[model samples]
Target: MYVAVKGGEAAIDNAHRLLADRRRGDRDVPALGLDQIVEQLALAVDRVMAEGSLYDRELAALAIRQARGDMIEAIFLVRAYRTTLPRFGYARPADTGAMLIERRVSATYKDLPGGQLLGPTFDYTHRLLDPQLAGDAPVAAPATREADTRAMPRVSEILTREGLIEGDGALPDDREPGDITREAPEFPMERDLRLQSLARGDEGFLLALAYSTQRGYARSHPFVGEIRIGELDIELDVPELPFPVPLGRIRVTECQMVNQFQGSAKAPPQFTRGYGLVFGQSERKAMAMALCDRALRAGEFGEDVTAPAQDEEFVIAHADNVQATGFVEHLKLPHYVDFQAELDLVRRMRAEAEAHTATPVKVAGKAAE
Candidate 1:
């Protein structure tokens, strides 16, 4: 039996060459530009940024191109690059309440303070692919309307007016964000840590967990109180500078989920909140994150934590797609020593069983004689 391993430096080199060729595709065809990926495939870029935990669209676009549009791989590339970046002083968290919203909508309210700006969305479009887009087609005249530049108010504020929503009552100045990347997610994580993890967590994984909660695994009746996709300023207060320096605007998606809760002896019943804010305009990811966030807070509301999403430890541990992928794919690598040990144990067990059976048969035959 000849099973020769073909992996070596030469094979690896060849593989890389082939990958480069494949990525570029046909030479006659126009190669994808980084700018094109960032502008045209904006949603894909958004996913990479959100999951990569990096805000730079240019870097994310480059990663996507290098990864051959494999989003998970692109995320891995970005996260790896992020580790090499020097840490400047942390900027104050962008205020979402004062965000220059591009798209703002609410499922809980018919009309919000800032009228809903439908912005660029696929929600109303038919799913069928237009043949005209096969080649570059001239862009049609865009529909024009008076831009709704109104400063949007958070929907939770309306509910809060009547004491219908639950909030920590702490002012914004009283809080600080914890970095999940710097520290391991120990049990009983702070709300900041939880949000940090969920924001960068695998979108599909979060979506499934959220779906589970909706299907009665951990029933938290959630309504999209408000979903706003916008750009917010990142400001750093440099000691040398007279005022905070503007670090430019970042596109982000923020979701606030209003869930039904009942009062226990400790507190009065009010609508509880689950929130999600991601690095890019990813409404689906944000919404799913919000749902899962509420599920993880089951214990806070005195609810039983039976579902997978409700268990904070489990969710956080498996939320990182990069980590999960590494753990799973590593099984395909050389496990020769581990498998050999298992094979030896199994062979010994089978021999012992066979001998025991023969001895029993021999003893029975002798007794009959």
Candidate 2:
């Protein structure tokens, strides 16, 4: 029953102009710069980039500005922009083991190789807001430390060495990991594709799902094995080059969760793993994604799938915020025809019911008379 209604071109144009005017704000105040957004509102930019599945800081910052700081809107813009870019080639898998570590820590271990470096985190900070931040205040420089050049071993590797945790199986040399961007997602997806979806999934949605597990909805009794944030070199193998060449470095956050599993007939008792990796310093998103990732692997480990997070079809289909928002927001568009049809049907049914009520019911003998 959808009907086209066209005559709002002028109104649409005026609305767009109003949006631009509102985005600019007060004339007396200076317009916000992209550089300021990149450096000052870095976490917001990072979130937009991570969810948008794009790595360009400049573009993400610009999207944030254009969206008037609406994160979902900003993400949509970046994702839309990403579709137009040409694909040169896929980069080699990032080797996080050799990453220039910024912040690395483990709740399971107090002392590990490359002892916990709490770099630029709000973990210990009080939640109270400072009035000084609202005004121009002199800022102090961050403390410096000697760079640790040694390769920091992954915490999961330690558990794997002791046979306490299951190993991440290596993929076949001939096979490349599935890319969700290039193809439609099918149910019962492989771990690689699932990971890719979770990496870019809505943070709040994943967070709620992760929280549900802790409350005994498909409980896994998980522990944060390690969380690391740092920069890693991205290399691309080109036909013209003899070997993979370094493209540049990008910051990322990786989280590993260890969940205990009981022994089944096919396997012995061991600790299972959930992994999350996302662009920029998104520790919360990484941790939540890891929890959901493990929950979704219930089938692989002979566990009952009893939760929303464990449902492959449900999680995969609804993870993308852009898709979710688009569908949800489309309801605001023209539904006049559809509503009119429904209204007419309801009115007709009501009138028929009223008419039938008004008609007197007669007894069998009296009706003939």
Candidate 3:
């Protein structure tokens, strides 16, 4: 049992005031609005929404403001706020195939049905800051065109048609998904839990885990089969309604990685897949997620599970940045009593050793004459 300490209320209040002042900054400058954050700094909001497990961009933008642009802290705020909202009903799973793709690219095939569309990307742009961006000059609008209406066939489906890739026939979408927030993950978990963990996992941690696999530790030899960034419609099935009603649409990023699988005694050689889906245009996060997803599937694929990324317990357990940071940061809190007890024990041990050393000569002989 720990006793509560009194005082520091004034200091805590002052600290909060100081934080607000720092967040606002210069009085002459215009205050940064939530809308501006949602519009201009959209990537940051997307990250918060992805990790926070909340879909509302407006709330995510507000959280980013309240957290003063600390993404992790904003994520924490969003997660906490999300729990308070009532669950009306589950929405139907998004149809990725029908997504209105704005950006689509493939690394596996030289040519796809819809030749790679580099819609909007920083891939070719030189990393230079334009001086005009600093001023209030009117920014030019980008050239717009009608999106390609042709159906973008999935790269995985194409590979599977040739029997080069394995397929999961008739997926059980109605099956209950494991909620990481509600329940703790167990070993040998279902695929849903693994996907859930990676979906909300810290980007940096996932990136490192993905990089480890590429560095030859549990290497899966993966290729970006396809990556699609687009807005997907979400619908909910109302029991009274004849058909599912459209709720709205959200921007998402999806990555499908093709991996080589060597034939084993029981199974024949084929290509497998690793999938990643995030809330927005997070290509790097999605790519890293796909690689980690593959690495975590070593057990199911008959590959060696020696690496940290391959260990289910290690990866899923530490994937949550909130849990990891909370446990680690708890050290900053008062531990004086515990430290005192340790100090007492250490001092006693040292004194006993010193006393034993000082009295040692009398034991061997009569005053060592």
Candidate 4:
């Protein structure tokens, strides 16, 4: 027997209250502070910042706390908040080359100009848990010695030194760098917009797409040319501050990949570029991102293509997690109205077909004996 249901408003209110209670656990145990989440769950905060397109650690932390540790939900919170923020004059594009690099390594060169620094990585660490202590207090890290010497050159510079890699010198000027947020994507695009989408894309989605390439769904032999993580200086053109003011720094992850080169008779064989950037030391995400970027770039040059990753329109359009999650999860809402309509349509169609077949057809011509 079917029963009529009511109490939509009361049910929602009760659910909200329950959620609030759960979010803020026991009164005896202190509620998790935003700072505590930011410091302890630093990587999640990084993903929120990267995907949300904002660099505020406090806001990221708050989003994480509010989301109850759901990364995508935290990202949605940050993105929503970021839109409300006033547009101050744009900062001069960050010089990642001049970054106070914490970690830098290149697989392309064994010995480059600036030596490889494997700064702060869990790459080689064992993933097994150690139950030495249940409670461990945060402690201050040791200070580092200042490098008072000359500025370090990029590892790419060494490749440019030998004229192997393309320096940013020969770029065209006819087309301007389009802002993806400000404008809709127009076709016959450059590498910048494509990279932006992949960089801010959901980690899991990008990871799966990248994994497909390695699993023979799409094949592009790629080498991690370099991966760097560091504090990048933020220079803002503030009217109040007038001169380019230093707006502190934020940690960043940068990955560069060297992929298989396909040359035409007209042009010499040159290494193609795949680049990725995130807010923190997310090497796996960055590497996956780089592969996707390289795959998309296949359309730019006339590379023999037969892969899902190589589809430019499909990749760029669907890469946004915020959009995907919204459309996907929106189905969970009251779709009973739509579902009922579909159910009626299918049942009626089936009944009509059955009756028509069962009834002796008015023969246009003589029925088969």
Q: Which ten residues in a row have the lowest lDDT in candidate 3?
A: 360-369
List, residue by residue over 39-89, the lDDT tens digit for candidate 3: 999899999999998988899999999988888899999889988888878
Model 4 compared with the native: what TM-score? Answer: 0.88
Backbone collision count in every prediction?
Answer: 0, 0, 0, 0
Kindly list the per-residue Cα lDDT of model 4 for residues 178-280, writing each as its tens digit: 5787889876556777777787888888888888877876667877888889998888887676589988888989888777765779766766667788887
Candidate 2, 1-369: lDDT as tens digits: 455768899999999999999999998999999999999999999999999999999999999999999999999999999999899999999998888888999999998888898999999999899988999899999978787677789999998898888987555678789999998988879889999999999999999999989998888899999999999999999999899999999999999999986576877888989999999998999999999999999898778888888898888899899999999999999888889989899868766766688674454544576
Clashing pairs in 4: none
Question: Distance from true position, residue 359, model 2, in Å?
Answer: 5.7
TM-score of 3: 0.92
Supply candidate 3's per-residue lDDT for 143: 85
Whole-model Cα lDDT of every candidate shown, in order: 0.88, 0.91, 0.86, 0.79
Question: After superposing candidate 2, which stretches have Cα over 4 Å from the reference?
Answer: 1-4, 169-173, 355-369
Best prediction by TM-score: 2
lDDT of 1 by residue, 79-190 (tens): 9999998888889778999888788889999877877777788788999999998889899887887776667779998898888788733435766667887776688887
The 10-residue segment with the lowest total lDDT in model 4: 360-369
Q: So what's the TM-score on candidate 1?
A: 0.92
On the 0 to 100 scale, the lDDT of residue 208 in model 4 is 84
